[model samples]
Target: TTQPPLDDESVYRIFNKLMLEGKVRAAVRFVTERGGGGVLHPSAQAEKRPPGVTLLDVLREKHPPQQQPCEEAFLPCDSLPPLIDVDITESTAERTIRSLSGSAGPTGGD
Candidate 1:
């Protein structure tokens, strides 16, 4: 009796397992330089080693929530109007008096 052939996922899983065990020598032979020089084989005297960071680390770093300044403070107010209809009289007219005073308010040199 013959067993069913391995599927793509099974082959990939086996390859990854071998790679982790440093048994996939031929696959790991193509070591391209970081600065796009070219591929080179591991040195003859080189010892097999596991990667410094696992694939999980790379995926975590890539998919981590992006940080933004003032992100926590800026909550979306969905209850507020989608479009503002500004009326001059309805809006508070607090003309920043410092602009008129030519002091450049808080934004200019002393």
Candidate 2:
């Protein structure tokens, strides 16, 4: 199934909700998984932070740093890296389907 593209507003909404709901960790996971190119496409440097680094760390370093309650704070605006472009080529899907089919045959049922 084809996935619809997510807009910037949707991303911001998700981010805001995740933070407000005390699900920052879940928000981070959502961004890491879907926030790429067509998604959030957060800065690459954001990933350089140590493993123990909290989502706040990524927010502070990538976006403009700001001082606020830990729970309400997010990555700084300036530190936020530009979003990367995510291109989903048809060949990529075809290759994946072929691999999953487990047999190089016309039926593709195997």
Candidate 3:
């Protein structure tokens, strides 16, 4: 089955949800893969911050840094990193189907 591309807005929604759930640490690891080769190519980075203030600082002010740093905060006016397409190979898709079907070819069962 072909997977639909996750638009930028979708990524922001997911990452923003993670932030609200207090799961992202330091920086959101936005990974993307092209051509459906099943390889992830994450290259997004947070923009540079002004002197005396950092992403951590802003996060702290908003949510009081929970042990780990918040990866994405969905700041009021900051632009989000670009989103890329992810592809799934036929073999990988088949494997996933098998696993979900509980076939466990060779391993018997887990």
- Which 10 consecutive residues of model 2 have the lowest summed lDDT? 36-45
Error of 3 at 93 (Å): 41
The alpha-carbon deviation from the true structure for residue 1 of candidate 2, after best TM-score superposition, in angstroms, is 2.3
What tens-digit string does per-residue lDDT give for candidate 3 at 1-110? Answer: 99797898987787788678865541154433321333223332224755556555665567864576476854566677789888999998888766552225434442
lDDT of each: 0.51, 0.66, 0.56
In the range 1-110, model 1's lDDT, one tens digit per residue, is: 99796777876776677688876543343221122333334432223435465545555657978878686788877696579786765223445434332224444432
Candidate 2 deviant stretches above 4 angstroms: 34-110
What's each prediction's clash count?
A: 0, 14, 2
Identify the leading candidate in terms of lDDT. 2
Considering TM-score, where higher is better, how would the candidates rank from best to worst? Answer: 2, 3, 1
How many backbone overlaps does candidate 2 show?
A: 14
Tens digits of per-residue lDDT for model 2 on 6-104? 898997898889989987766886867744432224434345566666655677757885556795466556566789998879998777666552234
Q: After superposition, how far is residue 89 of candidate 1 from its true place, in Å?
A: 96
User: Any idea what lDDT model 3 has?
Assistant: 0.56
Poorest lDDT segment (10 consecutive residues) of candidate 1: 30-39
Model 2's TM-score against the true structure = 0.29
| TM-score of each prediction | 0.23, 0.29, 0.25
